[model samples]
Target: MTRVPFTASCSTSIHKCCLVNTINIGTTSLAAFPNSLALPFVPHTKATSVRRISVVAMSDLSKSTVLVTGAGGRTGQIVYKKLKERSDQFNARGLVRTQESKEKINGDDSVYIGDIRNTETLASPIQGIDALIILTSGVPKMKPGFDPAKGGRPEFYFEDGANPEQVDWIGQKNQIDAAKAAGVKQIVVVGSMGGTNLDHPLNSLGNGNILVWKRKAEQYLADSGIPYTIIRAGGLQDKEGGIRELLVGKDDELLQTETRTIARADVAEVCLQALKFEEAKFKAFDLASKPEGTGEPTKDFKALFSQITTTF
Candidate 1:
């Protein structure tokens, strides 16, 4: 490791200001930095410095408040439990919609019963939150025996705030807006693959065109100017996580040929891992678990994240 002299200078109207210090890192440069992501990330806010700083990608989860929406849902529940495993680094909070839902969230998480569709309900839950991992969706309640892993179920056949347009698009948009207003440091969205192609099978449920709406929300989050990571997941299975090596790709490339499956628990792990990986910010990728006999799950998130083609 070597120490490099780091200086951040900003100019507004004919005035110039600079903050100078020496930083210890593996690699960085003044020119490459202007487009690079930084951590101990600076939040997007009026008080934040206009100049950008870049560091060799690293994730340090410490003394931050992380709020996970849809905490009562399958994926969110896993994230809620996992975040608590590192209680020294994060204050894990879960947002459910009702008292009944709150009771379903079993953990040391600070549970907030609130609806993502209602902006007013979100304010309190998002306030002072450092990071947000969004797993909420508008998928309609399933019919008995409707296993998403089984391949022929309508994934978004229900409505009443669970519709793709309402929950996936607008509800997610609401969460992004609230994150900005709260001055959140970062956000990670758990979205589905095939959203780039509206004709995908998963979109056929209830004529939902689910992927289309999810793309709208994805675009909104990208344009929201918040540091964001959008994990486009494959079939969300109910199997145990961390068993298979995760396959990660970009632009739905892997989804085009493989209609495979990944566990919801593993998706939660990816979302949690993105919290500290500065490399994942402003990037999106599609992920699915490999076959059962594949091998042990990859433990180095930064190594896996480094393999994705970053579009931002």
Candidate 2:
């Protein structure tokens, strides 16, 4: 997936004032037009005839508060820490569903306890947030009367109160709707790799339709008209891998590949990079590890993304 570049043009003439066009990646561009300063450039580069024009590319996230949902999750914690480390450029806010979870987020003034299922709970943390990162997952333990050990229709448990659809789909809808109402411009979602396929093994575990439900949520996000990036991650592991690299492509295209696991830290880094990339917006892609023999990291995410055309 490639993000479309937005550009603007300006002209200046000699010695009135310096006109600066600040190119902010992943968001709006700021063109400071001067009332008096103008410098006319000559074709020849001479000391007297030459004029200087400086174009500064500023990041859209600088000093902006980003609201991260599921801030107590593994990926959410990493994202929060990374954003906070760049505090000079960003103000990080974490949204948790419980006061306990909020406490787990370490008392950052930016952290707020609120459930995504309640749209009303979203308004406060979402207010003035420039971007949102969604990392919500289903409730951890199996509900009463559902036994993972027995293996007798574990899928039905998803429909019995601990419904994946309610949490994954409706919960996501609530977030999207609240974010939209809050006037948020950018969103990055962390989703599972097999989400586009109902037949995928992971779906079979919770119900043959959990992935389908996730896809439904994806569609809602896509139709929202909000600039978004969806990272469909493969089996998430907490262990460190020898080399860190991301193999990105359109959904459901790269199946039957082993060694697709990626470290959670690398995934967080990719999410951060996506916030700055104009090309990453409005795109949904799957992330997995490259083959062992495929050595060296590639700088071009677009080129890697172009290799696959199919989506779910």
Cα distance off (Å), candidate 2, residue 74: 1.6
Highest-scoring model, TM-score: 1
Could you give the C-alpha RMSD of every candidate to the true structure, in order shown? 12.0, 11.3
TM-score of 1: 0.74
Error of 1 at 207 (Å): 1.7
Worst 10 residues of 1 by lDDT: 13-22
Each model's lDDT comes to: 0.77, 0.70
Q: Candidate 2 on 1-312: residue-level lDDT in tens?
A: 233332244443321232344323233344443434332222342322322345422343235678888889888888888888887777789988778877776856789988777888888999878789998867434456776688775433444544667778988899999889988978888888876566677676555366777778888998999998888888777855445556875654555676567778767777777777677788888887775457676456566545544433
lDDT of 1 by residue, 1-312 (tens): 223333355334212111223332223323332213343332344533335443322223225789999898888888998888887677889998888888877644489987888899999889978999988887655556667787884434585657888888889999999999999989898888887676887788777777888889988989989999989998899998887888888777776665358998889988888988888888888998787777667788998888887543
Winner by lDDT: 1
